[model samples]
Target: MPAEFRAGERVRVRAGDPAGHTRAPRYVRGQVGRIVECQGSWELADEVAAGVAAPRVEPVYTVAFAAGDLWGEGGHEVTVDLWESYIERAERAERAGEDGS
Candidate 1:
């Protein structure tokens, strides 16, 4: 199935450190970014690490974050491939006046 998020959509990395292996990094958790590309479906890393056969799949998205947004300043923009489970639509309050709401 196609991914929920399309290119250009804003998303925030889900926060939390689940027990065992995970691909989401701690630094990127709770950070907002724009989806740059859709990388289709991939097997879940956590399940694979646990040796689960027929593990569930998830869509992967390339998200871009501005350097200033992640840090104080001077850092260049960075893009990272994140699984759908790791991100969600950025909150309405986060978007604020952009939606004219």
Candidate 2:
């Protein structure tokens, strides 16, 4: 199956303070990042955490974030692997001079 997220696509991590076991890191929550790679599907963690017998599956992706975007300047860029469910489509501005519009 095709990956839910594609490389070069901008996506945002779901923001919330829910009480439960989750794979998404707290530091990345609500942060916008570009998908660097799609790691394919895997067993959903939410189902596992909920104790479901038949675990659901979802695509996982490696996302890249600029240091300045996540933290103040002088920080280095970082990347994290996240599940599809942990992120949502985020609108991104066109690259400069790409469209020539």
Each candidate's lDDT (Cα)? 0.89, 0.83
Give me the displacement of residue 36 in model 2, in angstroms: 0.5
Candidate 1 per-residue lDDT over residues 1-101, each given as its tens digit: 67999999999999888999998888789999999999989998888998998878999899999878878785788888898999999988878855677
What digit string (tens of lDDT, one per residue) describes model 2 on residues 25-92? 88899988889998989988878998989887889999998878777764677999998989998743
| Cα displacement (Å) at residue 14, model 1 | 0.4
Q: What is the lDDT of residue 95 in candidate 2?
A: 36
User: After superposition, which runs of candidate 1 have C-alpha atoms over 4 Å from their true positions?
Assistant: 97-101
List candidate 2 stretches off by more than 4 Å: 92-101
Task: Assess every candidate by TM-score.
Answer: 0.89, 0.81
In TM-score terms, candidate 1 sits at: 0.89
Top TM-score model: 1
